[model samples]
Target: MTFVIDRYPCEESPRLGAMILLPTAESVPRARRWFRKFIAPYNPACSVGDCTLMISELVTNAILYGRADEGWCVRVEWFREGTSLRVDVHNPGFPANVRLRRPDADDAHGRGLLLVDAIAESWHSGPSAFGGTVVSFVVADAWPA
Candidate 1:
């Protein structure tokens, strides 16, 4: 599994950072840690805990359902938009497969998006510019006044 992190000078842009990860299970935690570290210095007013959880879920989904093969990696990017932070996860999987569903209580899987919908200020999934699908979410009032 390969990991790539890109950092931008804060003075140059509101773009926080981005990461490219192998579409594997291990990428989930790494994504979460990277997000925490990058967002920390800004002291975002949004709940870091919630953001962490949502990121975890999105990365997990990218690994599980987005990748077409080992060659197709997942990319995560975030930027500051006013007082909000927007995160986008890209994978080489079909956008049509990304959806919100009511999972049965007895089911053991398929709850990722449910949690995201509950936590994010707004979220959506669609075709990515590069290819495949991109799932994105926003955390409102992320930056402090």
Candidate 2:
């Protein structure tokens, strides 16, 4: 079945910033570009630049840990609720592991969520209804001083 994601009226969410339902590993960069668009007209105080970074982290994680021999897809969505921006990346993978650990001095990788955790006010990964999982983050719209 086809799904329709409603585009909120500009005034209904005039302060919002986001990218949504992107489908491809290539779309990760596209998501970044779209992120620029989403936040461009907003007050610099409401930027989602870190959200874009987390998108990269989560999407890369999905591509690395969740890719299957069967067909799979990935998507990213974002929006503003009050003073917080919500970023969500969805991918069609069950995940081989979902544990969070501190990054080690010698480790070259495995620090995606660590970065994500540091940036967003709060974030988590969850199973999706459409046969995969979602990583979501909420960030305060406070601009860097």
Candidate 3:
């Protein structure tokens, strides 16, 4: 599996960081670690725990549903918008398949987006510029110094 992270810094804003994963189950933990480390210094309203949980769920879905063949990958992007921390996950999967479904009590799967909806101030999914699916969420708190 291949991993790529891009850090884009703006003079007046928080650095925007992104990662591309190979869509393996391992990528889920890696994504969570990356996100936790990146946001460590930029305090957000949501706890790091919440953020990482969301990351895990999103990356898990990507690994499970994304096209992981050669040259295809799942992408994770994050940045600070004012007091809000925004995270976006994209995968080479059909956008139509990305949706929230109520999971049954005994079902272990299908609860990812439901957790996201409960935690994020706002969230959404759609087609990416690269002809894949993109899911994003925002959590707001205090601004970093």
RMSD of each: 1.5, 4.4, 2.2
Candidate ordering by TM-score (highest first):
1, 3, 2
lDDT-based ranking, best first?
A: 1, 3, 2
lDDT of each: 0.88, 0.67, 0.82
Look at candidate 2 and tell me the lDDT of residue 16: 52
lDDT of 2 by residue, 1-145 (tens): 2122334448577335434433456766766777667566555574456766887888777667665577665666667677666777777777446556786899999888988888889988778656677778888764443
Least well predicted 10-residue stretch by lDDT in candidate 3: 37-46
What are the per-residue Cα lDDT tens digits for candidate 3 across 53-109?
998998898878887446678888887777778888888887889889999999977
The pairs that clash in candidate 2 are none
Q: For residues 1-145, could you state the per-residue lDDT of candidate 1 as single tens digits?
A: 3888987757568788899998878899999999899878877888988988988998899988875644788899888888899999999999999989899999998899999999999999999997999999998888864
The model with the greatest lDDT is: 1
Residue 63 deviation, candidate 2, in Å? Answer: 1.3
The stretch of ten residues in a row with the least summed lDDT in candidate 2 is 1-10
All candidates: TM-score: 0.93, 0.74, 0.88
lDDT of 2: 0.67
